[model samples]
Structures are given as structure tokens and as C-alpha cells.
Target: MQGFKKAFAEQLRLALPSQEVTLERPKDYQKGDLAFPCFKASQSLGMSPQSLASLLASKIKIKDATIEATGPYVNLRLLESVRSRETLASTLGNYPLPPQEKKNATILVEYSSPNIAKLFTIGHVRSTMLGHALANIYAQEGYEVVRLNHLGDWGTQFGTLLAAYELWAKDSNPELEKNFPWAAEYSSESTTPLHRLLQLYIRFHAEEEKNVSLREDARAWFKKLENQDPDARRLWKKFRDLSLIEFNRIYERLGVTFDSLEYGEAFYEDQIPGVLNALDSKGLLKEGENGSKVVDLSEEGFDIPCLIQKGDGTSIYASRDLAAALFRKSKWNYERCLYVAGSEQNFHFQQVFAILSKIDPWFKNKQTHVPFGLIKLPEGKMSTRKGNVIFLEDVLNEARDRIQKIISAKNPELSNQAATSEMLGTGAVIFINAFNDRNTSITFDWNKVLAFEGDTGPYVQYAHARICSIFRRAGGSWSQWAEPRSEDFGRLHFESIELPKSLQGLDHASAQHLIFELNGLEPALKASAISLSPTSLARQLLTISKAFSVFYNDSPILNVEQSEAIRQSRLLLCLATARVINQGLRWLGIFAPTEM
Candidate 1:
């Protein structure tokens, strides 16, 4: 469908010269397959839309394409053999390979950024899954994609934690000792123990509220740390190392990897100075209360001012982001930069882009935010502060356990292939999240995500596996079923095949449907990459699977009449369909198993 649209669009450009023609699918399959409205061209050609369509219908002849006029629209139908063969060749021959032109574009994708000392929640899954999928999609398109884990490693929260640790170390608490063994013993006889850490943190914040001096003290400590206080640096490195060890385990289970690990803290020394200089040069910086520097964007309708430097002159998030962007641009010279973040920070990105635009207009349009919706639990919204969030590792493990049980019941013989089961289980989790449009709120439903049937990831994997089973039963290699040359196989007689005509009806209809759908891949990818919507690719995979189902049930490969040409032709088509499904699933970072 995509190829036909491109060809038709080009043909129209030549035919009308002065007007633009848009290709669309007819609402009803019975009204031909692809539709083109002639309304715009009518005025330019000095004729009614209907009349213009009629004129073009008479003059234009696309090889292997049937054209008809319906009211003000021109509908087209491709010769069955052409549609089948092209779809087959593209699927089987070109998949998993990038076009020569798109091979060099380098992309930096930052996602799944969970804060240190926080449990991996469903909210974290959105960016992680979405980023991984986008990276895969870009890589498939031949881009040298750099996956960066821009971890939230630096913040005032660490100071609070440190203070909490100090207070807790003064008192010996056994429960805290058990939970946080590493930080249990830090003080002398008056030392606070680990169990009372949370209470200590709360007390510290409460006192800071009433006593301005204590607040100033904490700020002073942070500044000292920022100014290369040896103790602060040592603690920061230890905390960062501990947090990453835990984070990497979750990432490994999710089958995600990053080309680099850059901490938010890493940019503090160099980034703060550069950003301050840039803001000062632009005259965008303004002093706020408590010695903090802020960028006032109230005129831009954002009530929240971006705090570049906090009170006591400590750098904040906005400053770090600005530094990161400048560093990335100068280091990689990326044509496009994407930030996969939660939608709650939509305004934050708007401010970031606006600030960058003021500083470097060239980067204004190039920087993009792919914001996704929050992941809510059944009870309500997840809160990391309350320690009420489901860990990502827990989700993956539960999925794997459930899959293992199902495998035990259905295919016990293959239980030894633990690696494959792990892949399928993890794939399901990714697909469940990726299947939806990224901006919509996702209610994590265990039943829906883990389902082995229906439109889930495992379902598609099963479908591919089923096809492979057919190839095995046939006792021959798929290559034995060569694609029929145009001369050898003339126009297909849909009725001549063993299956009922209605069976082919779906594929016949869907071949056109898929062609149109597949045609949107490039545009869809560009949109997804820009918008950070893995859901688009998810939807694409679903459509491909749906098309394959139609092809599978309607077309018979093994039991058809024993004519060598027809059998081979059908096999080639089936192989091509399978290839498309495999490649599409891969883009979503899901695996297509060879057997269920």
C-alpha cells in the first residue's frame, strides 16, 4: 500500500502539476482499496473534482494497477500478483537491513531514568521500554544509536539522606540494622542506628522548616561538597556506585543496555560555569530569593520558574540539563536529540527547549521531548516517597514465572530451553507497555500483559512459531519454495487455490491494507522518534500481526493442489509474511520465537 501511494503521489504530481494530491484508504474495502481525492486539483485544472477524477481515470495507466472513479475520488486496485510478489520480496529479502542512505545518522536516546535510592516503579518502565524501542527502531533504520542512561545521581536529597544517616547512626536500631546493614554502624555510643533513618530525615526537614540556620547549614555543606569537599565527594561516589550496581541488575533483566553512563553529578563542575556564562551573556538570568538564579518564563504561560542555581549558589536540575544538551551537541554533533521523559515534566522540557533556543537558535528545532503518561497502579498513583511502587524486576520475574508454568503445561519437552522462555516472558512485558500509545495513562493489568493469546507480544511470537512449525512439517527448507517470476505465474485466479475465495479475500484486501500501512513506517518512525511514542511502533506490529493472521488462515501452503508453481508461490508469500512479523517485533524489542 505504501509503495502504491508513493507511486500514485508521484504520478499525480506529474498529472496535475499545480495541485497537491493526498492518498488515503477507502473507509469500505468494497469501494476499491486505495483512494485519492481530486477536490484540490479540480480548481487548479478549471474543472469539478468529479470531472477531474474522470479525466485522470481515463488517461492514467499504472502498470498492474486498476483505477476507478467514484464521485470526486479516484480509487485504485493493484494486480494481485504484483502486490503479493512485492510484499514478499520486501519482507524476505530486505528486512533487518538498513537502507544505504540512512546508515550513518547517529542518535542519542535517554530513557528509563530512575533516581538512585528509589525502587524501579511502573512509571520508570514507560521511559525504559519506550527508549529501548526507539533505539531499536533507529538502529534498524541504520542509525548509530547511542543509548545513554542519564541517571539522576545528584540532588539536595542526597544531603538530606546524609543528614538522616548521621542522626540514625547516633542511635542503635536493630530493624534498620537488618535492612541497611552497610549504613548500620557509623557513629559512637551516641550514634543513630539505620532503623531510625527515615524518622531522622523527617525530623531534619521539620527542623529546617522552623530554624533557618539549619537550612543554611545544609546548604553550606552542599556548597562545600560542590566545591570539591573530599568527604562529600567520597560519599557521593560510594552512593552512586551502590545505586548503579542495583540499577544494572534491573536493566540486565529487561534486556536493555546503554552505550554510556553519565551522571547528573558529572556535569556539575564544568556545566555550571558554562551555563552561567551562557545565561549571563543572554541576560536571561535573574536573582530570586535566597541567592538562587532563575529564568522567569511567566510570559510564556509557565508559572514555574526554572531554578538554574538554588539558594546558596548550588546548581540545580535546569542547569544540569542545559549543560548536558550543550555537551551532547558539541560532542556528537547530532542532527537530532531526543529526551524520553515522563509527561509530568512537559513544562520542564518546554523551558529547556526555550532556553536553548534563546542561546542557540540552531538547536531550537532540533531538540525534542518524547513525553509519556504516568503509569498508575490498581490502587492509585505510585509514590516513591511512600515506598509504594512496584519494582520493574518484580514485574519481569513474575512474568517469567507465569510463562514457565504455562510452558510446563503446554510444551514440557522444551523446558530445558530456559533462555528462550526468559526472552518470551521479558518480551511480553515490553510489548504490553509498548503496545499502547505512549502519552495515554497505562493501568498495569497483570492478566492483560501476561496473556498468551490475543494481541499480546507472546501471541505474535506464537504465530511466528506456528509458521515455523509448518515449515518443519513440510520437511524442506523455505528456500525450496522460490518466488515465481512474472512470466511463470500470470494473474492469480483467486478461486483456483484450494482454500475458499473468502480466505484470500482478507489477505487480498489486507495486502493492499498492509501496503498502505507499511508505507507510513518512515513517517510514523519520524513522528515516534520526535514524539517519543513507542506506541506507534506497537500499533504497527499489531497491524502486521493482524495482516499475517489473515494470510495464514486464508491461504493454504501444504495442502494445496500439487502444482509446483502455485505451491512455491504460496510458500514464498508465507515466508515473506513471517519475515515482516519478525522484523516488526524486533523493533519493539520483542523476540519472535521459532516454536511456541
Candidate 2:
């Protein structure tokens, strides 16, 4: 299909000298397979579109290909033999191999940034999975992508944590002596321990609420930490170290890796000054009530002002974000920068981008915010503080366990339990999320997620495995016969082959339909990248798989009384279908197992 589109596009370039023609699938398959609007061509030639289309229809002659005019649309029907050869070749060829001219574009994808002293929540999984998939897609497109796990390693939350740690220091269990072990233990502890810490934080806030002097003290402590005060700095490092240990374990389980690690706190010390200067230089900084510095985006309809600096001269989230953006732009020099964050933070990113654009207009178009919807629990929204969130690790383990049970039931003799567990478990979870619309809230349902049938990842993997089984049954090297070809094999006949009535004829009509569908891959991939919607690609894979399924059920490669040439051709088609499925699945971070 892609080849046909390219061929048509080149043909149009030569035929329509003064007008641009777009090759597109016809609105209805009956109107001919592919269509080119002749409105522009007609205008260029000072004739009616229908007349111009009719003229071109007579000139273009393709083998077994038909051309027709439908009003202003010039429709082309692909030869069945040509499509069969093309689809077979595409299925056999290594698709989406590294492009020759690899773009030296650096992209910093900041995602899965779970906070320190926090467990991995389902919401965290959404960002982690989505970001990793996007990174994979970008890499396939030949971009140098840097996956950054921007851990929430620093914040005022640490101040509260420090206060909590000090108060609960003595009650620490030796078994829980590891860093941030208290995070988990604290969840089960009496409210006494956490309540005390919360009270201290609240007390500090209340004291500073009216007394500017007390607020200055908290700022002084935070500044001391930023300035590398021994005690404050040591405590901050301990929290960061402990949190990373937990985060890395989760990342490994999820099969995600980062090229760089940047602390939100690290930016605070040095990046804040630069950001403040840039804001001041642009004359965008404004003094707000209560002695805070802010960016007023009221004109942009964002009701809440972005707090750049706190009342006590302390930098805030907006300040760190501005610094991070500048530092990233300078270091990576990325052609594109995508921020994979929750949709709830839409305003926050808008402010960040607005501030960056004000500082450097060149960066205005490069920065993008890839927002995704939330993952809610059956009861309600999950909250980390409430300890009501499902840990991503727990979800993964549960998925593995479910797959193990199914494997035990279906194939008790299977060895390599670990490998099978990983494949089924990870594949199931990824497919569940990837198949859904990115903007819709996903309710974590075990039954739906673990189902082996329907539009799940396992179903696709099963289809690939089924093809492998067929090859195994053939008892010959499938790879040896599979090769790319430009011309169609003449042996294949749609009328003789018994296929599903829906996909019966492999004549011009069916071939054209298949060709048009195949042409959508590249554009679909681009759309998936732009929208961060894996479902688009998922749907395409499903379509291809279903088409192949019909072909497999109807066409008999081994038993048919045909020449070696025809058998090899059909085998090559099967191989190409398998390759496309594997490549597409890989993009979604889903594995395609050779066997079920």
C-alpha cells in the first residue's frame, strides 16, 4: 500500500504540472480503491475536474490496474497480482529499520517522576508507560532520545519529612533500617507518628502565617540546605539516595531506563538565579501580594498566577521548572522537547512554556506538553497520602501471577517460568493501557486487563505465535524463501482460492482495498507520535492481523497443488505479516512471543 501511494504520488507529480495532488483512500471502497482530487488540476488546466480526471484516467496504464472518474476524484484500482506481491514483500521485509539520515535531534522525555518517600501509584504507571512508549517511537524515527526520570527528589515536602524522621527516629525497626523504609512502615503505623510530623509542619506554617520573622527561619534552613550546610545537605542526600533505590527497582521491573537523572532540587540552587534573571530581563516578573514574585497570566485566561518565588524569598515549582527548561534547552539542544505529565497540570505547563517563550522566543514552538488522563481505582481516585493507591510493582506482580495461573492451567509442562511470566505479565499490562485512548480515564479492572482474548496484547501475540506454528508445521525454512519483490507473482487467483466471503476476491477490488489500508501506516505512525496515542497504531495492527487471519484460514500454502513459486510467495506473505506485527508491538513496548 505504501509503495502504491508512493507510485501514485510520483505519477501525479509528473501528470499534474501546476497543481499539487494528495493520494488518499476513497471515502467508499466501491468508488475505486485510491482517489486523487482533480479540482486543483482542473483549475490549473482551465477545465472541469471531471474532464481533467477523465483525461488522466485514459493516459495512466497500470497492469491489471483500473482507473475511473467520480466527479472531481480520480480513483485508481490496484491490480490484484501487484498488491499480493507488495503485501507479501512488505511482510517479509525488515520494516522501519534505522533511516539513512539519522536526525541528530536530542529529546529529553521527563516522565514517571514519583515523589520521594512515595510508593509507585497507578498514576505513576501511566506516565512511566506512556513516556517509555513515546521514547521508543522517537528512537524508531531516528531521533537521539534521552529518557530522564525526573524524580521528585526535592521539595518543601522534605522539610515535613525531616521533621517526621526526627520525631519517629527512635521507633525505627532494625529490619526497616534501609533508607525510605519508613515510607512503607509509616503507612501502617499509628497516626501518632505521621500526625506529629504533620502537626510540626502545620505549626511551622501557622507560626509563619502571621509572623514574617518565623517564615524567614524556614527559608533560612532551606537556603542553608541549598548552600550545602552539612546537616541539611546530608539529610537531603539521604532522602534522595533512599528514594532512588526504590525508584530504580520499579524502573527495572517496568523495563524502563534513563539516559540522565536531574534533581528538581539541583536546579533550585543554580538554575533559579538564571531563571529569575531571565524573567527580570524580559520584564515579565511582577510583585504579588504577600511579598511573593509571580507571572500574571490573566490575559491568557489562566486565573491562577504562577508563583515564581515564595513570600520568604524561596524559589517554588515554577522557578525550578523555568530553570530546568533553560538548562535542558542549552544542554540537549533538542529540536523537540516533550513533557509527559498529567492533564491536571495543564495550567502549570502552560505557565512554564509561556515564561520560557517570554525569555527566549526561539523555544516557543519546540516545547510541547504531552498530557494524559488519570488512572482511577474502582472506588474513586487513588491518593498517595491516603495510602489508597495501588503500587505499580503490585500491579505488575499481580499480572505475572495471573499469567502464571493461566499458563499452569493451559500448559503445565512449560519450563522457564520466569521468562513466560515476564512475557505474559508485562505484555498484558502494556496492551491494556496502550489499546485505550490516552485521554480517557482507565479504571483498573483485572478481568479486562488480563483477558487473553479480544483486542488485548496477548491476542496479537497469539496471532504471531499462530503464524510461527504454521511455519513450524511446514518443516522448511520460512526465512529462506521470504524475499522482497517488485513484480507480482502470476500464480495467485482470487476466484480459485476459498477465502472468507468478506475478503473473498483477491482481484482489483480486494487488492485496492488492502493497498489503501497499507498506505495509512506512515501517516498513522506520525499521528500516534503527535497525539501520543498508541491506540491509532494498535488499531492498525489489529486490522492487519485480521486481514492476515482471513488469508491464513482461506489460503493453503502446503497442501495446495501449486508450483514451488506460488507456495514460496504465500509463505513470504505470511513472513511479512509477522514482521509488521512484531515491529508494531515493539513500538508499544509489547513483546510478540514466537509461541503462545
Candidate 3:
């Protein structure tokens, strides 16, 4: 597929040396699949744009492509046969994919770094799914992908937790609180560690407004924790571990995994001094208000210098990020490291990357901060302290329960109800946000997510299941058409079943459209991966689903009266659609259930 684009580009480059040759998609299919505008190139050639396009359309020789001149644009369409036998076959691995244009190298994707001490909220949905899908797409492109969950496990938050814990101990008594059912040491039978920590943290802030000294006490505790004082370290470790236990449960339920789970601020505490020393030696460190130390990124256009060290000699988040970058570089030796963070941190990252670039040139080109917009409820942005935050686990579980109830009402006898309900419900939550533009804030709407029609996750998954049902009903389905039956076809092996001789000559709008959609799988996947946006692929998958549905309605597979041969051929088409949909949804981190 890439070869076609390259060959076409080379042809145009040879004919028009001065033009920036690019193949654009026509707004309407009638204009052709790809188009090249010739207005500018025509001037150099001393001809009208339409005339130049016509000349190129006639002169450029492309096998299996029909070139047409439309106004000032030259449009081209691949012959359906080349699409069916070559592109389709390659996507199904009757042949290998065109050699990868990119060299195989490692990339580390760091996402879902929600701060510990607070439960994961509805806000994390976009980053987690976006990062997950990008990782999947990167692997599809043959990159050595490392998925890192950069847990926000360090910094002043831990200090706040320690201070709260100390206060709670004094007020409630350590012995009594320890013996309480939901204790610091979580057990297999008990829960609520996360709730306890969150309550303490929120209450500390609340009480601090009444007694200002509480804030100082919290800061002191955090400083002690940073200094690795025994009691403070022990308490900090307890908060960190218990928080992770809660986090792991959510990750497990949501089907998110990490190759590495590294603490951000705490992990870099030991190296932060050296980070400051390097900045100091290089004359990058500037004195900020009071005794604080900072990096002057004013030239990068900031009003205030980026504070690296506080007045009390404590390191801030920016300093931790700088040290973490150094740690990740030496540790993974990755070609690229993407930080999937919220869009609010855009300037913060730019400043950090700018400061790091001053200290280490290698940091500038390789590191990327992939920012996304906020996830807001219908009312507005939520806050944990205000008690308005929606728990992520609750949302996921509700999605499952609601789906299960619907299944019970609609298809009471459906097998594997528990498992199917879980997948579909979780997919609903994920799908609602999957196609949203990364920089646009999305308002959660249950009505929209659970909708049966339109581009919902259930809608796509149902299409896969519907295709599966077609094949199951067409018993002696193409799989057993051969002398010996083969196992089910996967992404790489769809060509195993030979199309019957009579079916080989199959050509109709339905067959042609289905094959076209099937052949387009690779290109859509490529575009999605390159753009680092899952919605591109998500939108493409929806197109394939709608196209397959049209083909399903217009073309008869098992019920056709013509002959068994044509029936089998249509069955092959159905199998191909199911395979593509299943694989595509998997890449999107959504399920394509075999049975709806």
C-alpha cells in the first residue's frame, strides 16, 4: 500500500520538478480515490491547470491505476483486481506487508500518571485509552514498544498524606485506628485503603484553613520524607504501596498494563541534587524569590523562572521530571519517550524540555509531551476536594452492570453473560471517548455511550458479532470447504481458504466495495499510527462497519439462490470483514465480541 503512494509520488516528481507533490483524497468518491492539484505546477509548464492535469493523466503510466483529469486535479483509482489479489492478500498475509519504511527501534510511552493518594477518576479515561491504543498501533508498525505507567508516586502529596496520617494517629489513637476494619495494612478480605487516604488528605486541607500551622506541619513531614527519615519513610511507603494496590485493581479491570511502573518524584530524589549541580555549573540555575533556585526559561517566554528547588532547598516537580528524563534515557536507551499528560501541562513540559535541552542537547529532539484535554461531567470539571469527582472504578462497574441488565432483558439465554457484559460495558465507556479529538474536552453522557445505533463501541462490536453469526449459520462455512478443515483465520492467514473457481470471477458493487474496505485496513492503520491519534483509525473502522453492513444487506451469502459457489465466495467476504473488524477493535483496545 505504501509502495503505491511512493511510486505515484516519484512519477509526479519526475514530471513536475518544481511542484510539492502530494496525493489528496477527493471529497467525493466520484472524483477518484486520490487527487493531485496541478494549479501551481501548470504555471511552470506554461499550460492551464486543467490542461496540465490532462497531459499528466495521459502521460503518467501506472499499472493497475486509472488516471483521470478532473478540472485542475489529477485523480487516480487502483483497479479492483490489484486491490483484491495484492492489497487484500497482503493484509491477510498471503504476502508480507511492504517492507516497513521506519527502522525497528524502541519507544517508551508513559501515560496515566495519576497522582497517588487520590483514586483514579473519570479524568483518566482519555489518557489511559489513548496511550493504550497508541502503544498497540506502534507495535503494529513493528516498533519495539515499551508501555510505562509513570505513577505520580512522589512529591508534596506524600508529605500531605504523612502529615494527615500523623494527625489522625494523634486524634484517633494509633492502636484503635490500626485495629479498625479498614486498616493501613489492607487484607484480602478488607477494602477502603484508598478512601481512608483520600479522606485524610482532603481533611488536612480543610483543617489547614482554620489552623494555618497544619500546612507547615504537612510541609515538614514531606521534607522529612524526602530526607528519608525512618518514620516518615515508613509511613510514605505504606501510602504508596496501599495506593498501588487500589490502582492495580482498577488497571486489571480496565485491561490496562504497564511494562514498568516507576515513581516520578521519589524515584528521582537521589539524582535531583546532581540535576541541580549540573544546572548550577552550566549557569542555568537562577536565584528566584527568597532562597529558592530556578532555571531561567524566560527566553523560552515565561514570566517566572521554572522553580527547580524551593526556598527551603526542596526539589519541585520540574526538577523531578528533568532527573526522570535522564534516568529513562540511560535505563531504556529508547529512541523516543512520549509523556501522555493532560493539556494543562503543555507549558510546564515545554519549559522542562527547554531547561533540559540547555543541560543536555539529546533531550530536545527525542522527548515529546503528548497532551490531551480534560474529561468533564455534564455539569463541569470535577474536583476531589469538593467531593464532586466520580470514581473511575464505579463508572466501569456501572457500565458492566448496566450492560448485564440489558443483556438479561434482551438476550436472556446468551452464553458467557458475565464475561460478555464486562467486555461490552467497559468497551462502551472506552468507545465513547476513543474517537474524540485529543485536545477537545468531552462531556460524559451515558445516553450516548449506550446508544445502539451510530458509532458507539457496542455498535462496532455488534457488527463483528453479526458477521460471526452469518458464518455460523452458513454451516460448512468456507473453513470446511477444503478437503481438511483449517483453524479460524487470523490477521495473517485469511488466504488459507481458496476462493472457488466460479467465485474468482465475482464482480459486483457489493463484492467490490467489501474488498475495497478490506484492502484499506493497512492504510488506515498506518495513518492512525503516524498521526498518534486513535480516532483516525476509529473513524476508519466505523466506515468499514457501515460498508460491511451495506454489503451484508444487499448481497446474499448463504441464502443466495444462484449457486453454492457464489454463496461460498460471499462467505469468504464475510469472514474477511469479521477478521478486519476484530483485529481493528483489538488495536483500539475495544473488544469485537463473536456473539452480541
Candidate 4:
């Protein structure tokens, strides 16, 4: 289809040698398959748009297409023969997508950096799915995509948790109480460890309000952890390991995988002294109150100092981020690195990137902070210390349970009950986050996400299942189409097949509309990939799904009034719709079910 458009554009050049011609799909199909507006050029040529359009329309002569002058535009209508089964061959291999502009280009996408002791909150879901989709889209464009989970494993918060654990949790594990007085009940079983850890964390924050000395105690324990004291190191390692096990369970359900995991703050702990010393040597580090180290940014448009290290000589986030950025450049030599964080950290990331650029002028513009909007529940924003956050795992489990009930009541005879429910539920959760623009704040609405009758994931999935049923029934009745070694049902790569003798005589408008949308997949793929938004492709898939549903209803596939040839042609259309829908859905990290 892309080649055909290019060839048609080249033909237009011959007709109007002095014109810069661009072709567009008309809003109304009756206008034309492709329309070119003559008004812009005609004004400079001192001629009316209608006259120029008519003149150009007369001069144009192409095979298997007709030209017409409609008001101020020139329209082109392709013959059925011009867009036959052979036209779809590009979608099979690599016909649709153009060659990669830069081969072996590496990109690191860092996202879903949930803290070690906290549950995976709803906000993590947004950043995680966004990064996952971007990685997939980048990979399709031939980039060496690396999905990095920059975990938040080291901070003052860990100190608070340790202090809390030492005070309240040491007695829970009597054996550990004797050997290591600070370690909590490190449950080998995954279920209770996270809950106990979060409880201790909350308790520490609540107690810190009444007892002022607890803050210093928390700071002291964190300083010990930072110094890698043997006892503190053991507990920190235990907390990190158990937390990962629970996190992986959630990620597995979402189908999100990481190529590299880095504790950015922790990974740079050793490099902190060297980095700070370099800053001092470069005259960037300055002394602050109470024996603290800071970098004055007044000249750089900041009123406060960017603290490199706290008064107690413990490194802050900025110091560690500088080390991590240099380390990544040395390790991957990546052309581009994206930090997919929340918008709440906008100023902090801005400070980090700005200071990194000032420290080394060569490191500017190569890194991006793609801060996404925060997801708010109906209640409001979440706070882990207050214990008011809605857990992502709980929401996913609820979605799965609801879908299983739907399947039981609606699709009782379906054999793949377990798999089907998961596919639908997971697809529901992913689709809502992906279909919304990344930079826009959106409320979590399970009603809209799970609706089967509207513009929702289940609606599209059912459309796929509907197409599969049509094909299955048609294949069984007409064994000729499914002859052994001649055809298969794994995937319908039917672009090269000759049009059946019966389908040659059909010219229904519904069939034409379906064909037009199918031809647009290649351009849609390029648009979605280049714009760095899967929502473009998502919206396109939804368009195709809705169109197919309309076509199926208007044109009967197995009605007694229709001939066998008509039935075959409609079935062929159904196959084409299913292929594009399935392919497009997968591109957006959605699963299309064969049966709902």
C-alpha cells in the first residue's frame, strides 16, 4: 500500500511538474480514497482551486485508478484489482515497515522503581506499562532496547524501617533475637514478610511524632547500613531479597520483564567520595551548615544549595545519581537513556540533569526525564507511611476474579477457562493505562476498562473471538479451503492467495471500507513507533475493531439468502480484520483471545 501511494505521488509530479504534491485520505469516502488540495498552490499560480483541480484531474492517467475533481480537491479511487489479496503481502514479513535509520542503536528505559519495603502502588503500574510499551515500540524500530528497573533500595527510609524492626520485630523471631538483635522475622514464605515489613515501617513513622529521639536512632541505623556494618548489611540484604520475590510475582502477572536491574543510589555508594572530591577540586562543592557539603546553584537560577552530602556525612540522592549516570555511559555507551519517573520528582530530576551537564558539558541532552503524571484514586493521592495506598496486586487479583465470573456466566463451555480469564483481565489493566496519554493524569476506572459493549479491551477481544468462530465454522464446512499441506490455521498469511472465483464479483461498500482500514496498518505502525506513544496505535486498533463489527453486522457471512461465493468473500474479509486486530493489539502489549 505504501509503495502504491509513492508511485501515485510520482505520477502526480508528471502532471504538475511545478507543484509540491501531497496526498491525504478524504474525511468522507465518497470524496475519494486519496485527496489532494489544490487551493494552496493555485493561489500562488493566480488560478482558482476548482480550475486547477479539474485541469490536473484531466491530465492524470494511472492504471486501476480513477481521478475526479471535487470542488477544490483532486480525488483518486482505486479499482478492486489494484488492492486485491496480493496488496496485503507486505504485512506478512517486512513490507510495511521501512528500514531502520540507525542500526545497533542502544536505548536504556528505566522505570518502575518501587521502594524495597513498600507494596507496588497504583502509580507504579502507570510508569511500568508506559516503559514496557516504549521498549516494545523501540525494539520494533530496530533499536537495542534495554529495560532497566532502577530500584529504590537505599535511602533514609530504610534507616527508619531498620529502627522500627529493631524495636518491635526482634521478639517475633526468637532465634534471631539472640544472635542478631536488630533483624526482623525474615519469613521464608513470601506472603507475610512484606506485610510485616510495611507494618514496621508505618509504626516507626507514627512513633517518631511522639518520641523525638527516634529520628536520631533511625539515622544512626541508616548510617550503619551505609557503612556496611555486618549486622545491618545482613538485614538490609534480607529485606531486599524478600522484597524482590514479591515484586517479581506482581511483574509476572503483568508480563513485565527487565533486562537489567540497578540500585542507582546503592550502586554508586563507593563512588560517592570520589565524586564529591572531584566536585571540590572543580570548585563546585562548597561548605554548608553543620558540617554539610553542598553545591551552590545561585548562578544557575536556584535559591538553595544542592546538597551533595548531609550534615552526618551520608550521601544524598543527587550525589548517587551523578555516579550512576557516569557509570551507565561507561557501561552501555547508550545513545539515549530515558528516566521514566513520576512528575512529583520533576524538580529533583531537573537538578540532577542540570548539575550533571554543568559538571561535564558533554553529557547534556543525551538523557531525558520522561516524568509521567500521577494516578489518583477517587479518594486522593497515596501515602505509604499513612498506610492509605491501594496495592496494585490487590487490584489485579480483583480484576481476575471479576473476569472469571464473567466467563463463567457468559462463556460457560469454553475449555480454556483459566488462560482466557487471565488474558482478558491482564489485557484490561494494560489497555486502560496504555490507551490514555502518558502525560495526562487519569482516574482508575474499572467500569470503563472492563466494559464488553463499549470501547474497551473486552470489546476488542470479543471481536477477535467472533472472527475466529467465523473462520472455524467456515473451515469445517468447506474442507477445500483447509486442505492438508496447502493451508493451516496457525496464522492466516493469506495475502498471496489468489482471490476465489466467487469473491471476484463482489463490490459491497462495507467490504471496501474494511479493506481501506487494513491497508492503513503500515502507516499506523510507523506513526505509533515514531511518536513514542502506543495510544496512537491503540486508537487505530479500536477503529479497526469497530469497523469490523459494523461490517459483520451489515454483510451476512452465512445467511441463506447469500451465495457461497459471497459467504467466502465475507469470510476472507473477516480473516483480514482478525489479522490486523491481533497484530495491532499485540503491538500495544494486549492479548487477543480466540474465544471470549
Best by lDDT: 3
Q: What TM-score do all the candidates reach, one by one?
A: 0.83, 0.81, 0.89, 0.86
* 3 against 4, candidate with superior lDDT: 3
lDDT-best of 2 and 4 = 4
List model 3 lDDT by residue over 1-596, tens digit each. Answer: 45677777889999888688988756554455578999888887788999999999998878887888989999887776555554344544332233244656888888888788888888887888888888877876877788887777777767788888887854654442343332333343224767767767777777788999987887788788778799998877787888888888887777777886765457787999889888999999888898999888778888868989888777789988898888888887888888889999998988888887899887777888888888777898877765567677777777888889888998898999988988898888887777777888877666765565688788788877787777667766433221112221112323444444444424666667666666566677788777777877787788778888887777777776677667765666666676677677777777667776
lDDT tens digits, residues 431-456, model 4?
Answer: 77777777888666667655555767
By the TM-score metric, which is better: model 3 or model 4?
3
Q: lDDT per model, in order?
A: 0.67, 0.67, 0.74, 0.73
lDDT digits (tens) for residues 1-596 of candidate 2: 65567777777778877577787766565675579998877886899988988888877765556877778887887656665555444433434221325778777678777766666666787788888888877776667888876676665666555544544442663322233332444443313333233334444444455776654455566666665778877877876676677677777777677776664556456778888888888888899879999988887677988899877777777788888878778788888888888998888899888878878987878888888888888998876544456666666777788878887888787667667677778787887777888788888777776777777777777777777767777766653332222211111111111211122234434333444455455556677877877778777777767666666677676677866665655555556566667667777767666665
Model 1, residue 268: C-alpha shift (Å): 3.9
Cα TM-score of candidate 4: 0.86
Better of 1 and 2 by TM-score: 1
RMSD of 1: 7.4
Off by over 4 Å in 2: 1-7, 13-17, 26-33, 38-55, 70-72, 94-100, 170-224, 263-268, 299-301, 479-520, 559-563
Error of 1 at 460 (Å): 1.5
- When sorted by TM-score, best at the front, the candidate numbers are 3, 4, 1, 2
